[model samples]
Target: MSLLNLAWHSLWARRGTALLSLLTIALSVALLLGVENLRTQAKSSFASTISGTDLIVGARSGPTQLLLYSVFRIGNATNNISWDSYQQITQQPTVKWAIPISLGDSHRGYRVMGTTNSFFEHYQYANKQPLRFAQGRALENTYDVVLGAEVARKLQYHLGDKIVVAHGLAAVSFVNHEHYPFVVSGILQPTGTPVDRSVITSLAGIEAIHLPPQQQAYSEQQLTPSSITAMMLGTQSKLQIFSLQRQINEYKGEALLAILPGVALQELWGILSIAESALLAVSICVVITGLMSMLSTLMVSLKERRREMAILRSVGAKPRHIFGLLLLEALLLSVLGALLGLLSMYLILAAAKPLLLSQFGFYLVLTWPSLQQLYLLLAVVIVGFIAGVLPAWRAYRYSLSDGMSIRI
Candidate 1:
């Protein structure tokens, strides 16, 4: 029989033990590749959360903090900007549009955002993709509210449902605006961004809910907004962004800060890169452990196969042939495990995608393995060959007498 056929038959004889080692390697590879896939896709998701807008203007504070509050909805603003300042900025010749945001209230744990029609009109994400309505229309009246996809789905709310707003941004609040309940007029489509988790309403709607019972009866035009939490600015020219940002920062009237969304996002990711590295390190360790287990199994099997090796030598097989056969067996196992690992990763991701989208608004795109993953597979094979060397050498050193005699 040929060397390849001999190696194949030998592996088949020990298929039970070989299968366990293959499974261990397979699971380790799956975990390693899964971590890499999530890290890459998550960074892409976060960077594309808010796009098309030139700058995020907010109360003077740390750039990271402002990004967290305005874009991610993770925290509250330190201060509010005067409506007069908002008007002044919007009226500038370089400015094309401004969407004012007033945040402070919540509806059943989800944040309530107070903004104008421009928010739905000009806001863009994932390469300037416009927001689409899954149902109903934008806020036409002060009390007409809009619901995000996640907000509606989680609360099981539909259009025309009356919902009360809370005074604070908490899941459960004692102070509720029972008298000024809002009617859900619109529901936005899922964008896999923070927008999916927000409750949108008109600026007048926000002011009305917070006003005294007597003031709630006033028309939207009569109830002027005193301050806004932040503003998303779109400039006429990309070149003017730095000039506009500098002007907003140096305004003499009130404390304000302007940040380029891309820059702030990069800085935020830099802080998170450390955690990504640690995850990769742990995965690498797991893969090494799996390889070691495969090596141990192969070494133990060498003892049982000594008689077979002796028979092959009697038929004129060289010691190097014995070495090559053991090496080839290890390579076959590693290659099979890597392929199985990739398959397992894709299946798990497909199953978890919907739950992740609904619960966290994170969209994980399914794609083929990246070049890095290919490199990792290649590394596994190389390591497997190296791991087989010790056992192969032991087989090579065995004399014909060692396996030929049966000790009683």
Candidate 2:
């Protein structure tokens, strides 16, 4: 029989041990590839959270902090900008439109955002895709509020449901605005962004809720918003972005800050780069451990297969043939492990997609293996071949010395 066939039968004879090694490599590969996939998808999801807006204008603070609060609702604003400043910036000739944001409220842990109808009209995500309503329409009355897809699902809220907002951004706030409860006017479609976890309402609704029971009777026109947390501005021309940003930053009315959302998002990602690198390093170590396991299995198997190699050598098999046999076996194992790893990754991603989207707003998309994954698989095969070389060489030397020794 050929060396290739002989190696195949030899592997089958020790299927139990060989299968264990294969599974080890497979699990390691799956973890490595899974990390890469999550990192890529997370970056993409983050970058697509907000689009079309030229700048995020907020209280003078760290760009990343402003981004966290304004765009992601991750943190509180250091300070709020005056309503007068928001009006002045929006009325600029270069400005096409602006959406004011008022934060510092929550309902069952989901952030409550106070903005205008322009928010639903101008806000964009995932390559400038406009927000679509899953049910009902944008806030039409002073007490109307909108619920994000996740918010509605988690809280079991529907249109016309009266929900009270809390004063603080906590899941169980002691201060609740039960006196001025809001009726759910709309529910937005899922966007796989921070918006999915937010509760949206009109600016007037925000003011009315915060007002005391006596002042709650004030008209929407009379109660001008005193201050807002942030504003997303869309410039008339892309060329005027820097000019507008600079003007907003150096405004005389308030100490405001303007940041390019994309730049701040990149900076935020850079801050997390160390964590990403650590994950990759850990995965690499696991992969190396798996390769070592494969090497150990092959080295241990060599002792029992010495007489088998000598028999092959007696049948005119060259030392190179014995070397190729062992090397090919290792390569086959690695290749099979890599294949199984990819299959398992897909299965895990498929099963977890719904849970991930619901809980973390992460939409994991399944696609064919990426080029990076291909390179990783190639690297595993190379490592496997190298791992086999020592045992293959040891067998070759034994075969040469044993000559025609057939005693098993």
**RMSD of each predicted structure:** 1.7, 1.3
**What do the candidate models score in CA lDDT, each in turn?**
0.90, 0.90
Any runs in candidate 2 off by more than 4 Å, and if so which? 406-408
Overall local distance difference test of candidate 2: 0.90
- Candidate that scores best on TM-score: 2
lDDT of 2 by residue, 1-408 (tens): 776788788789889999999999999999999988998889899899999989999999899999999999988898999888888889999999999999989998989999999999999998999999999999899889999999999889999999999988879999999999999999999999999899998888888877778763687565578999999999999999999999988998878999999999899999999999999999989999998999999999887888888878877988889889999889888888888988888888899899998889887899888898899889988998899899889888877777788445
Worst 10 residues of 1 by lDDT: 399-408
